[model samples]
Target chain A: GQQVMQIPQYQHVQEGEDFTTYCNSSTTLSNIQWYKQRPGGHPVFLIQLVKSGEVKKQKRLTFQFGEAKKNSSLHITATQTTDVGTYFCAGIMIYNQGGKLIFGQGTELSVKP
Target chain B: EAGVAQSPRYKIIEKRQSVAFWCNPISGHATLYWYQQILGQGPKLLIQFQNNGVVDDSQLPKDRFSAERLKGVDSTLKIQPAKLEDSAVYLCASSFQTGMAAFFGQGTRLTVV
Candidate 1:
């Protein structure tokens, strides 16, 4: 039973502070993706990492895929009220069908002004 | 571009009742996925369809849950004799292909009392 695990099930940060969430998979992954879900909204695709040790950035957000492809992380700098939501990391295992995406328990984030 | 679409934004039924949710994936997307997200948790994959074929459903609770993506287009998931634990948001997502980023729809939130 392969599984994706995320650390810090919850995070609270003051506006302008930075926050980070980590993800680890029980098995090697072919690729990893990051998604953001606003309160009461659907999960939206943020970014995807395919290459080993790949790193991508979007504005104040930074994403990294481990060299082994079994772990990933998402970091956001200078939190804002609009950033209040849950961050989820999903992975596709090397042996699984390409469409069988697995997700980790999200890390709920809250920002205080 | 239009995103994935789901119907009946919310539902509430007594335990043992049956319920079904529908979804239409983005135009031209070939992959569709169904996931269950309990409150405070991440979305868990229930099944995956590639075109009109079943690619993976290892995690789906077959005893009470079933889904179909007939015609390689819109899909539906049904749960019979639902239990209180079945209370969760049913999320439908689509992707252009395997190992690609997924676009999710506003999920159908189900409450089984």
Candidate 2:
């Protein structure tokens, strides 16, 4: 069985503060994806990192994949009130048969104005 | 292109009742997944389908839960004699390929009393 663990299950910060959530997988992953779920809304795809030691950015957000492909992180800079939501990291493992996906317990982020 | 679609945005049923949720994935998508998400937690993988065939269902409760994707198009997940613990959001997602970003639909919120 594969497990993906995320840290800081809850986070609260004032506007313009920076926030980061870490994710670690018990097994190596073929790729890691990030998603966000707004309050009372569905999860939306954000970004995906494939190569080892890969780093990608989307505006104020930055995502990093570990060199071993066993961990990942998401950092949000200058958080805004509209950034309040749950951030989830999903790890995809490729097996000889197929690929299996697992999600980490999301980090709920709340930003106060 | 249309995203995943799920029916019955909300449901309320007493314990031991039966309920079913439907999902239609994006056109030409071959990978579909069903997940259970409890409050304050990330989505848990329940089952995965690859072109109307079961790929991974190890996490599904066979005794009370069942899902079917007929004609490699639409899918339906059914829960019979649901229990109080079944109160959660059932999400349907689809990806164009394995190990890729999954597009999720607005989940069906189930409240089992």
Best by lDDT: 2
The TM-score that candidate 1 achieves is 0.97
**Candidate 2 Cα outliers beyond 4 Å, as residue runs:** none
**Per-prediction TM-score of chain B?**
0.98, 0.98
Where model 1 places Cα greater than 4 Å from the true spot, the runs are none
The positional error of residue B79 in candidate 1, measured at the CA in angstroms, is 0.6
lDDT of 2 by residue, A1-113 (tens): 78999999999999999999999999999999999999999889999999999999999999999999999999999999989999999999776558878999999999999
Candidate 2 lDDT over residue span B28-105, tens digit each = 999999999999999999999889888888899999999999998899999998999999999999998878889999
DockQ of each: 0.83, 0.86
Each candidate: RMSD to true structure? 1.1, 0.9
Residue-wise C-alpha lDDT for candidate 1, range B7-52, written one tens digit per residue: 9899999999999999999999999999999888899999999998
**Residue A6 accuracy (lDDT) in model 1:** 98
For candidate 2, report its TM-score: 0.98
